[model samples]
Target: MHVLVVYESLWGNTEQVARAVADKLGSVGTVDVVDSDAAPITVDGYDLLVVGGPTHAFSMTRAATRAEAVKSQSALHEPARGIREWLNLLGRPSAAIPAIAFDTRVDKPRMPGSAAKAAKHELRSMGFGTTVKQETFRVHGYEGPLLDGELERASAWADEVIAALGLGSRADR
Candidate 1:
């Protein structure tokens, strides 16, 4: 199976989790890990899609125009870019593929289910099957030293995805 893992990261915590997911998913099949900024991804070539982002101020970032003309004005209104805009720009996949959603967020003991919830809603609206489920990797500080052992946790999560999806060769079992 071919899997594509795409992500957006402000401070690299999300990137670390994306890498761990890609690495673990690769253990079962071919995987391509991409930064969401690299546009025009061919989702038709892959069997699984994994989307990830970071939670900022309890919401996913809102998409914005790049030109300076709207920057100041949009900054006041939009704030951040959400994966929904990115997926919308990419358009819906040609075929419905199973997908997993994830995010990296500050481990505030109080804050719960913001980014992952947003990601799942966006992905389901895009017409992907909600098989792999939404998950979160922890980040300690804003810039993220990354909660220790989160990568391993991500790998373990991916293993569950593989088993649930029945991916991997016979030998992999």
Candidate 2:
């Protein structure tokens, strides 16, 4: 199985989770990990695609929200285009590719929404088959060192995704 893992991260938390996911997926098959800004505009060749980003304003970051992140976080990397824009530009896939979506969000009292949820919807709209429920990894704050164990959780989630997609032959590794 070939897998592509793409992510948009303002403060790197999501990127770290994406890497963990990719690393775990690597055990099952070949995996290519890239930032959303560098991801392909079309989904082809890969059997599975995993996409993730930081939750901004309750969902995927827009240009305005990215600007806000840049203004508020000194260490944040300015991305050319976030997952929202990348997905928008990525037209519907020609064939059904199994996909999973995840997001990094602040561990607030009541987080309003989820980027993963919105991303899943977007992927389905783009004609990709979503094989796993959307997942969220928590952060302590906006520019965060993710909540404890989130990376490990992300890796575990990757294993689950592999199993769900019936690509579990190498998951034990």
Candidate 3:
């Protein structure tokens, strides 16, 4: 299974989760991790897509929110287009491409909204099938060092995604 993992991280917390996910997927097959800004418009030649970002204001971050993250908040990089915009502008795939969505959020407050849920909805609307359940990794606060063992859990989630999707290592394949 060739997996393309795209992510938008404000303070590198989300990137950590993405990396853990890629590590597990790499065990099964080839994997590439790309920042959302650099991801291809068309997701072709890949068997699976993994999209994630930090939840901003209960959902995916927008231009204004990203700007705030860089200016008013503690994000290290300059503000730019994020997963929300990338998914919006993504070209439809020629064939059915399955996807999994994940996000990083504050672990303390237990927010109601989820970026993972929103991202999966967008992918489905764009004709991508989702075989695995959406997930949320937690952080201490907005610009945060992730909580303990979240990376391990993210890696384990990747394993579950592989099992659920049956991408490879199946007798049929």
The candidate 2 region of ten consecutive residues with least summed lDDT is 164-173
Per-model TM against the reference:
0.82, 0.94, 0.94
Spell out the clash pairs found in candidate 1: 61-80, 61-81, 61-82, 62-80, 62-81
Question: In order, what lDDT does every prediction score?
Answer: 0.74, 0.88, 0.88
Query: Clashes in candidate 2: how many?
Result: 0
TM-score of 2: 0.94
Q: Model 1 over residues 30-141: C-alpha lDDT tens digits?
A: 8888777763445888898888887655656555332221353232223133465667676677899888888887776547556677877877887888866788888875
Clashing residue pairs in candidate 2 are: none
Question: How well is each residue in 1-173 modelled by candidate 3, as lDDT tens digits?
Answer: 68899999989999999999998888777899999989898888988999999898989998988888888876896437799999988999889989899999998878789899999999999889986889999999777889999999998898898778875443446
The per-residue C-alpha lDDT of model 3 at residue 89 equals 84
Q: How many steric clashes between backbone atoms does each model show?
A: 5, 0, 0
lDDT of 2 by residue, 111-150 (tens): 8899999999999888899858999999987888898999
Q: What CA RMSD would candidate 2 show?
A: 1.8
